[model samples]
Target: MSVRQTPLTCHGHTRPVVHLAFSGITDKGYYVMSACKDGKPMLRYGDTGDWIGTFEGHKGAVWGVALNYDGTRAATGAADFSAKIWDARSGHEEHAFQHNHIVKSVAFNPQGNLLVTGSNEKIIRIFDLQRPDAEPAKMMGHESNLRHCEFYTENIIVSCSDDKTIRLWDVTSAQEIRKLEFPNIVSDIEVSTQNRLLTLTHGNTVAFWNLDNLSLIKEFEVPTQIHSASLKPDKSIFVCGGEDFKLYKYDFDTGIELEAFKGHFGPVHCVRFSPDAELYASGSEDGTLRLWQTTVGKNYGLWKCVQAPSDLDKPGDAEG
Candidate 1:
């Protein structure tokens, strides 16, 4: 077993990083992107945690950041009420998509041709990348904000909201397929397929559902309000982070705590697994990003990283 190590640190944003995503890369992976309430987005090298550059465009805080599978483009949602497309490497603005209200979440399809944006306006808009000027295929059902969305397949998209439900959407018809009810407002959601769903409860719980029957397979108990959760390809081992500023990993078969990661002094907002699932990353209110090594049944410690700085002063950027 390998012990987790803090090999590097970078610092820049003044606000806590609310979202983080890594491109689908295995060997010599290139970039990891982070979004903050400070109105800045950052891209860093995965292996070394080196600062690449800042994506300076949004006027208000950035709510979400998503990179395509190949990692060529990045889509950002902001409190500015818009979603913008940016060059993943150059940090150049490719397009500015206007929405009626603050954009809360954004996701890219598996093929990277479709971009989806959900907003407080109670609307989900799907845009075709090949045709930038085309009208978006819209899906409207939720009466409240669509908080987070996960594209399970080309035809299916799962979204969770403040309305306390998880909705499944059909991309071809741009209509809602089903609405799965939950006990609390959803904080985050991930899917391995249309049949499997992993939802982080608003409070301190994580639940896995088999959408085929809308039945709960496992209700993994957690200690803190989960800010985010990430799943493995096999859907056996997973992790969640919360206000306690700790990352907890569990084995799905037993629902027992496998390991706990401690580093962020502030609330952890986002967590993600690398494409190969050998590594995972977290973003936090500490204005920092952390990476961890994971194993199936064993405990791997924390490999937390905090980045370098920007010329502009922001909230979470302070070296904590």
Candidate 2:
């Protein structure tokens, strides 16, 4: 029998955590950024869940958060009708781009030169970070409010909405390239640039797609209604949580459930794998973030291994 590992629970949020993002591994290690309904966004050391600093200024609930590749910058979208960019190291707001309605999601392009945002106005906007004063390029199509958006590539962007469709757009042309309709509203999407796969969760289905061609790779029916799902960096397994207030892990290829444990007292809203795939983090309506090990009993970060008393030799038991 295997011993269940205790997850590291991170506290501080006063309300539900709506979104979470992990930065790429940096020289100082990676970082985790979180958005909460309390109108506060926070940054923490990714490995240890140590609170770093909170980005202040939003007057309404923060809905989305994103960290740049090198962990030097962060972006957030909020119900305050704005998306703001922050200097990750200083926790200072650099730019606040105002929107007509609530901004639901934000993403930084690979080069960190551009930012894209989705809003309740049913539009997607691309802002050039280099020229903060310039007007942003807009893309429109969805009849309902936007849920999430991200850059599929340097020249392409992908967005999902309450309209039950995911659309891909050419950034340069500002035109829709393709549309994927789902039977239910897509709640979450994970784009793995490293693995070239797109993971989407909707209704009771978790689907994987080929990022290059937008082809259907595989789809699995989950037992519970999941809001978010993230694939391991190596593509071996995935972890997800949702309405049932339980975290689940499953084999990626076999679609076999590996683990299902209840940790959060409330529903989980977001989950993502660490850059190293050492562990994954989940944000919940309980107003906390929990980190679980990919491989239990393995010593990584703050998770140290301990030997049982019977396994340890007596003081004088060993020969010199």
Clashes of each: 13, 0
lDDT, candidate 1, 185-231, per-residue tens: 88987766533665556677788877655677778768888978887
The Cα local distance difference test for each model comes to: 0.79, 0.90
List the candidate 1 regions with Cα displacement exceeding 4 Å: 1-9, 26-30, 194-196, 295-320
Q: What is candidate 2's lDDT per residue for 109-206, written digit by digit as tens?
A: 99999999999999999999999989999999998999999887899888899999989999999999999999999999998888888899999888
TM-score of each: 0.87, 0.95
TM-score of 2: 0.95
